[model samples]
Target: MATPPKPTKRRTYDAAFRAEALRLASESRSTQAAARALNINVKLLYKWQKAVQTPVAAALGASLDPTTAAELRQLRATNRRQAQELEILKKAIAIFSKTDEQ
Candidate 1:
């Protein structure tokens, strides 16, 4: 009787490895180009790129230092709020000016 072959286990990538793969793929002309240079699968590199932008990564902010990442989040939120407020003021001014002209 012939012996059965052992099943291969799935490969697990560390955070650093995933980050480097993303950086290389992004810096290149295209993911395909980068994958070719790195000798990794194009689809796998594409998956890593998408994974970095996911909410889970944003929640953890794994790429940057904790303090800097937190500050970035705060600044982005503040800028968004300010932008909305500016839009409202601009619309109000436009409306009031139109009324005055009429």
Candidate 2:
């Protein structure tokens, strides 16, 4: 007797996750690379990109001026660098303290 085929489950993402995924896609070199990193289909990422290109979504993004966007990008880069430095300092402290205990 032939076995029954299993039903496929569709995964649904929330608005926040969708927004983050879109942002990641824009920052990545290619949509396909971003989709692969996020474990999602490239077509789906393209769909989201199309949706965001609509008038309503475009208007929302238009609220930020080019200068403001550039400033925000710089600030985010600095913040990321500082966060990494903080993590390295924390690890160094742990190692130094461990050695002092000997």
What residue runs in model 1 are displaced by over 4 Å at the alpha carbon? 54-102
Give per-residue CA lDDT, model 2, range 1-102, as digits (tens).
Answer: 999999999999999989889889877888999999999999999999888674654666768766876676678779989999999999999999999999
Model 1, CA-based lDDT: 0.78
Clashes of 2: 0
By lDDT, the best candidate is 2
Worst 10 residues of 1 by lDDT: 52-61
- lDDT score at residue 45, model 2, on the 0-100 scale: 92
**Residue 75 lDDT in model 1?**
84
Would you list the C-alpha lDDT of every candidate in the order shown?
A: 0.78, 0.86
Over the stretch 1-102, how does candidate 1's per-residue lDDT look in tens digits? 998999999778788888778767756778899988877788988787776564855666557775775576578669989999999999999999999999
